[model samples]
Target: MTRTNLSDIISCLSGYDPDAMSVTQARQVINDFVPPLATFEKLAIRSALDRVLAQDIVSGINVPANDNSAMDGYALRGDDLPASGERTLPVVATIHAGQHYAHNVSAGTCVRIMTGAVMPDGCDTVIPQELTHAATDGAVTIPAGAVKTGDNRRRAGEDLRTGQTALRRGKILRPADIGMLASLGVAEVAVQRRLRVAFFSTGDELRSVGEVLTPGCVYDSNRYTLYGMLKRLGCEMLDMGVINDDPAALEAAFRRAAEDADAVITSGGVSVGAADYTKQIMQQLGDMSFWKIGMRPGRPMAFGRIASGDKEAYLFGLPGNPVAVMISFYFIVRDALLHMMGAEQAPLPRLQVVSRSAIRKRPGRTEYQRGILSADDDGIWRVRLTGEQGSGILRSMSDANCIVVLNDDQGNVASGDLVQVVLFDGLV
Candidate 1:
């Protein structure tokens, strides 16, 4: 498939400015540039969970396939029901589940049917066993107001009719979806292949875990967090460990990641610091945009498409701060990756809840403050900021259950004021 050029995508957006981009503008650019993968594979239903459907699943048979009893009851003709008093009928035969009575049930006689048993011909009503009394004489008595026509009977195709769509394309299959497919007698389904995502962190001061901690060096946590987020999204990840700030190493990492995966995500080296070689290397290999977004914790970001030889992949250069990396991924990269995988994704809901404390804020930029959401005594949901909202404080993110989103035009917030928050549970 022909790929859309990044330059053309950016040019089409009104008021596009990379240096002073807003969070909404950056998101729109990524959404417009990314395209869904067309490649798909057929897999057994057991292996298709969480995978996007490639085609609609159409049912060839009715769900029930026949009119059957919904409960253990006496199947009788509705016309024989008496107007005021109880009526007794002879029990001609008994039918268990999966059994079919071929002969018609005559008036004044009924069949003792178990749940799921096919109703006898000419019987349209079923009086539940508890509503009827059975005698030693092989007869049952039903009260006048017990049941009407079509009671306790499941009709054919009530759940799904022939040639009806059981599931639509682009749906992410869940456990219930798998059960539905099984009910239609489908053993295999066509699903889009898992998205391949390559991610890494860059900084000379970052070290891997289990290594000796030298002076001015810290262990990398962004990669671990990125892995967890990507795993939850069902993407196959290639974790390229920490890369030094050298220009040669940065260029090689970008090229290799682009060649190997459908998308590349890197934390660090997108800011305007002198040692930030990632921006230069990315610009040289592809049509990249470096932005100073009007957002807190994650203001510096790089987004574009890069190519290596005949392969090309989308690249997202996030900030080095631990908390910023997470906020960027959740707000910007998550939905774009889902779209590329051909999954139908609904926007995460932002709920407005009362604030538990006053918050200092400035206009002209968005801020994502890590928050703890809880219920008050009256069962009203409220939010409070995690202490020490620093970008490098990864613990704040761990303690937070939601993100308090302050819009670009919003200012300081007073206690008891309503604030918009997106729950972490919903994003994952």
Candidate 2:
């Protein structure tokens, strides 16, 4: 099925205004307009890292499979321990992880157990080896308060029960997820196919990395940055290089990209200052919206779908400025593309922090300022702007660890005022 049109979705919202779209409103529209692709691939569990699960993984058996000891210690019945002070018990047999004790543990006696070893029958408590004192006659003394009943024991099916869902569908697999599957004895998994994304820059003045640059031309950095971002997101990226602003070249590039990829990202030519032909050509080939979003840096954006004969691909037309391209890609296109890849990821949290300095901002627009988060003298985390907030300044993005988000209705931020920030890097 095709995605819902933006106009149809906008009509559902109260007091909808297209000319001045809020960040939240824009996001909602995009969410409604984009749907997950329906394709899956089978992959080995180890190779499925960062891939979205296509089906729920139901546990065939309990995770531990049997009741086991969580520590190298003595396992005995709780009723056998003295109420206070200490109790001495005879050690029946030693249980290693791979082997089991054949006989049930008798009353007032304990079985020496290693970590992950099966808990002897009739034993409900464990005292670590360090917490117990061994007597001359192979008896072990455990202090009254050393452990409670069922202490240091891992119950069967505690982590995962048989016939229960171990991992849900649409979840992006991570290291912990892979390890969990391994523990479940799952060697392979079904995952959504990787998304194929084609991107390019649209400027005659832009040159490739190895190409000799003219006096007025600059090397294209957007393609390199786009490559890194898409690669990190586990996408199959097709860097289409720089397509000149000429009509024939632009149309040919768009057609080829739509035919080969699930999505196309182009930088430049959507802004009002550019040739009117940019929007005209886009509309001629597909259904698109040229929007002036109520945001700083990345105000101009074209979002819709383009067709090449029978094939079609989603299009994201970003601004020409370096920082604007990155900002727009992160805030607007990233989530939509992830959805296309069939990944159900939680939204990046916007954490609140105090601003270290004053920032001038106008109301009715959201601002994304690159910032460095640091601890103050009192160890309170605060954010400071990395440098100039100009959209053309790429170094600001590089030096920043986070992005200070100023709300659409909010004005200038005074020093020490609480502001919302989204971290670029996080400890997983």
Candidate 3:
């Protein structure tokens, strides 16, 4: 498929300004630029957990297959019920689950039925066993108004009808979905191939684990965090170790990543700095854009598609600070990757809760403050900041259970004020 030029996409967005792009605008650009992968692979339902469906699953037969009893009771015609007194009906037959009663149930006669047992030919209702009293002469007594027609009877195709779409395309299959597919007698299904993401960290002052930490160098923690996040999203990852601050090395890394994966994510060198060579390399390689986004902690970001000879890949250049990298990724890159994987993407829900402390903020920029959410004595949900809010403070991200989102127009938040927050439970 032919990809739309990044410039063309940008030109179409009204008031599109890279220098002062809002979080919403940046997300829209990425959404419009990334396209879902068309390639798909068929896999057994047992192995298809968390995979996006490539095709709709049409049911071949009705679920339950026949009109069945939903309760262990006596099945009889609804008209046989008494107007104001008890009615006794002779028990003609007993049917268990997986059994079919072929004889018609005549008026004043009932069949003892177990759950999942097919209803008798003339039975249209079932009075639950608990509501019926047994008689000595092989009969059961049902009280007036005990049940109405169709009460405890499950109609055929109630769950899924023949030729109906049981599951739609772009669904991320879960355990329940697997069970549903099994109920439909589907052994295998077509799902979109996993998204390939190549990520790396860049800095001369960065060292991998097991390496001796020099005076000015720090151990690289970004790659490990990136790995955790991408793994949770079920992406196939390529972790290219820390690249040095050199033009040639940066260019080679970008080319290799673009050629090898469907998308490339780099941690450093996007921000304005003398030693930052990643931005230059990205611009030289593809249609990249460097922007100072209107968000705190992660203001500087780069996004575009980079090419490596015949192969091309989308690029996301995040900030060097640890906290900034995570915030940028979760807010910016996560949805784009899901789209590329052909999965249905929904916005992460932001819950409104009261803040327990005063927060410093401004009106023009958005801020994502790490916060701990808890229930008060009154069982009301509340959030408090995780001490200092610094872009480089990785510990803040760990201690917090949610991120308090302050919109661009929102200013300082006072104690007891309500704010919007996104939880990190399934996300982080």
Clashing pairs in 3: none
Please give the lDDT score at residue 225 for candidate 1: 94
lDDT scores of the candidates, listed in order = 0.92, 0.88, 0.93
Q: After superposition, how far is residue 388 of candidate 1 from its true place, in Å?
A: 2.6
Mind giving the per-residue lDDT tens digits that candidate 1 earns over 149-212?
7799999998899999999999999999999999999999999999999999999999999989
Sort by TM-score, best first: 3, 2, 1
Q: What's the TM for model 2?
A: 0.97
TM-score of 1: 0.94
lDDT pick, better of 1 and 2: 1
| Model 2, span 1-428: residue lDDT tens | 56566567777977666678777877777778777889998999989998999999999999899999999888999888778999889987888998988788989999888999988889988889998886433788888888888789899999999999999999989999999999999999999999999999988899999999999999899998899889888899999999887898889999999899999999999977555356677888998877888998899888888899999998999888999999988888888888898888678899899999999999999999999998888989999999799999999999999999998889999999999999998411
* Candidate 1: pairs in clash: none
The C-alpha RMSD of each candidate to the native structure, in angstroms, is 2.0, 1.7, 1.4
- Runs in model 3 deviating more than 4 A are 135-137
Candidate 1: lDDT of 28? 90
